[model samples]
Target: MRMGRLRHAMVCSSNQNRSMEAHSLLKRHSFDVASYGTGREVKLPGPSLREPNVYPFGTPYKHMFDELRRKDPDLYKRNGILPMLKRNCSVKLAPQRWQDNAADGCFDVVLTFEEKVFDLVVQDLSNREHKLMKTVLIINMDVKDNHEEAAAGGKLALELCQELEAVDCWEDSIDDIVAAFEKTNNKKLLYNISFY
Candidate 1:
């Protein structure tokens, strides 16, 4: 009964359309669909936490990286390969003046974090002079957006991470966010993180 309740709770936070379509597709194909959060309880995969696990880098990048490690090991590992020392540490959306500054042969992934997280990642990336790559991947996690879309957002699962939402709960207008993801093929992996 406890497990049953938990499963329902997990499902409840999923996208309605995506869930229904995925379930229907899986059933017809004799498959299954499961979901989870990417932060808190999750131990950063493969590689343990870096020396400064508690990022002054802000919440979004921290949570996003945590979630990435939980879901996509290879991608996360690639991320792990990037220069551990952040050069710059902040990002923002430029309206109209957005330019194509991306060059070739950057890191294995091209991405961005949300709001404050983006700011931190951008600042570090810019400071580094794109040492990670011509493009900097902003790692971030969605702790809120309690609405349908952000339902899969990672909640702080760490006892030490009690202030999960407090960190990543910023709302900003990053117009090219989805475009960046699509262009880079950087996917939002399942939140495999869990706590007993």
Candidate 2:
């Protein structure tokens, strides 16, 4: 049984894939969860990966989904993009940036699916340490951008959250949280689609 509520932030490069999946799953499990993207400019697959439609961080999901559906129906449908976008839209209106939540300081744990996003969030927090001087555990778990990989990552995140909830010292130290997460999820691989 959960002792109390925990606020979590899941982040990735585009916010449309891995983090969003984790966000949805986490929320379903009754955690106060938010998802963000670390990209300076939001990107979506167009006719090809070589040419993607770029938007800003707060761009509405509906608009981007419509654009993608219109721009490249074949690629979008083939890659199972609409279902993800629809699920995102059902949960939230737009994508948020890591900077957007820094001022609020609402999250107890922040999980990033990629190293780039992890570094960006760490640097962002480091620059404003005085203003936001709270113990927020940040973890970098290597999860791929594909759907299968994202679902697997979401499962890992849910398991970690459950494990952390049961730990008494999870909030005291980041090292303890990481150790518990790794120990609880030792059999699961970080990058591949396992435990799904």
Candidate 3:
């Protein structure tokens, strides 16, 4: 709304997949978008379910990609991590933690793809000092963490953003917008208002 487009933040447990997928889509649509993770460490699938490759928040996507490819090119490629990292590298330099990004500035809307992440984002916002006194809408639409689900969720997130963009005053029309979206998409959404 600031520049005739809603500034958005897409969040998930790890910025590598779901959030990044939506981030890419939103960026392509020319939305002011940023993506983040709620997890303490960035975690990705390893060779087995019991093992996961972990990195600190600031590790470059290229580094993770090269390291994973070196560790097991075939396995990572098969599991879609390689391709995901390649796509992530193109979207941004690294995975960022939501808690660590308070100074990154305000967003008009923050969308999380998981309930836990929504909680984390809400908690983070609540704990911050409300210097801007700006109201931000936080919405959660459950999205499964997988290639197909991420792709589908990205499109759905785009649709929701477009709906919001079309409104002259989002605050006044949010209820109707959410109701229409839920009825049409058959998806329940959880939303809250927080200050920036």
Candidate 4:
């Protein structure tokens, strides 16, 4: 039961589209927010479904944008990868892996966009020592990994965060907040309580 802005983390498979969109929106609202990927590497759509352009977690967004532009400017631009990379560059330097960010400090809430990412986050948190004994709310709201869906999901994430911030005792009020959010957004959210 603390009162203040809740620190948030938005996670997705690659942190290119969905997470970044939510991160950008949350940041705009002046929320203490960070974003991460659950995937082993950062992956962007390539010319074919089987061929995804992959980069290490630490690869700079600007570098990816340049490389993608050089590889096939028209293709990347048409697919929205270039624009996503451009937007990501403005939000953060690179995509970070969720498993590798344990030292980054604790977050009050972590919102993942997919069930697999939610599972990975839960598993990673479960393996860590509860040094702080601080509870973090991990919520998963399934959002399609696309530009349009990302935009809509970002708004919903913002709305949920607003509801959370309004409550003094979030742990006590979380169930109600989630229920109201689900009713309003018509989206089911899977949540877990984890310790830092």
Candidate 5:
């Protein structure tokens, strides 16, 4: 385990250094920043969800919520309204983003299928001081297009993602997620180090 962790650390370090080298280019470019760690213990859906929840329906707008309530009543009831709704809707709290609303901030990502519906989502995660985000990413399951519509979809997704938020479209592990970020033009290291 120690060796495994050491290996992870080294790979991460090397990748991070490469990212550092891109600082000048990134500054000139428009990179999206995000960090994620995978856990098979909670492999509810795809690669990386902006929130922590992993429900079966994946949308809070309708049928999914009722489905979850019926399927996992025990797990559903104990978690409470927001969490239950999130779980049923396949959403979860954006850790850093939610505090402000608790502390008097705003709303964030509510739906996942459209950008025009951005404001409907709540901004549960934000660090105005650093511009860190709520749902740092929105992992998807498709990667087959490099056309204008696809690029537009990416931009729209970016729009839905908070100003400093992020999104991914993969089914791999966190290492792949990090590598994707590093290899893309949208990789930003918003908060490399933290007090916690």
Candidate 6:
């Protein structure tokens, strides 16, 4: 409704997977895109699932992968996280959290991949001191944390994003955008897949 390419922010529990995948897809479509996590620390497997490495947001994906690969090549390969991390590195500069987005930098729409993240972002937007955030629309479409699931979720997000960009909603309100988006897809833009 703000009438140009809608600025978007995709979020999940960690900036490592789902959000980053959606970020990559949306960015490819030329949407003003950013991604973030709601978690306190960046969580990723080191040598195994039982001992995940906790890192800061801006830590490079390659750096983490290299570290893990150095520690145990077989374990890193078996986890299959390396491929996902490799893909993520090609798109995003680094991992970040939802809190990294400033009030002044709030996007036109903030989409979450999980219900908990949707609630967290809703609250994050609500507590913002900037009134412009009132115009921001937040929607949650559940996506499991895996390669295929993230890819499918990213594709779905792209479709919904395209619909939102194409439609000409007269009213710039959040409700109007939501209504128009749903109307464009002829279905609610909610994806819940268990293929993972």
Tens digits of per-residue lDDT, candidate 1, 126-171, equal: 5444333322223333333322333233211111112211223212
lDDT of 2 by residue, 81-164 (tens): 877888888778998877765466556778888887878777776666454355666777988788999999999999888877
Report, for every candidate in turn, its global Cα lDDT versus the true structure.
0.27, 0.75, 0.91, 0.90, 0.27, 0.73
User: 125, model 1: CA deviation in Å?
Assistant: 0.5
lDDT of 4 by residue, 27-73 (tens): 88888889988877988899998998999999999999999999999
lDDT of 6 by residue, 72-184 (tens): 77876777777777877888767877787544364666788888888877776666565432366677887878778889889888877776677565134446656665676
Q: Write the number of the candidate with greater TM-score, choosing between 5 and 6.
A: 6
Tens digits of per-residue lDDT for model 3, 26-106: 999889899988888999999787899999999999999999989999999999999999999999999888888945868
Q: Estimate the TM-score of every prediction.
A: 0.22, 0.85, 0.96, 0.96, 0.19, 0.81
Cα lDDT of model 2 overall? 0.75
What ranking of all candidate models by TM-score puts the best one first? 3, 4, 2, 6, 1, 5
Off by over 4 Å in 3: 1-3
The predicted structure with the larger TM-score, 1 or 2, is 2
List the pairs of residues colliding in candidate 4: none
User: What is the Å distance of residue 105 in model 5 from its true position?
Assistant: 19
Candidate 1 scores a C-alpha RMSD against the true structure in Å of: 19.7
After TM-score superposition, what is the CA distance of residue 164 in candidate 5 from its true location, in Å? 13
Q: For candidate 5, what is the total of clashing residue pairs?
A: 15
lDDT of 4 at 133: 92
Give per-candidate clash totals. 18, 0, 0, 0, 15, 0
Candidate 1: Cα lDDT at 107: 28
Per-residue accuracy of model 5 over 101-158 as CA lDDT, tens digit each: 2233212212122221121222222233434333223223121222333334344334
Per-candidate Cα RMSD to the true structure, in Å, reads 19.7, 5.4, 1.6, 1.9, 16.9, 5.8
Candidate with the larger TM-score of 3 and 6: 3
Q: What lDDT score goes with residue 32 in model 6?
A: 84
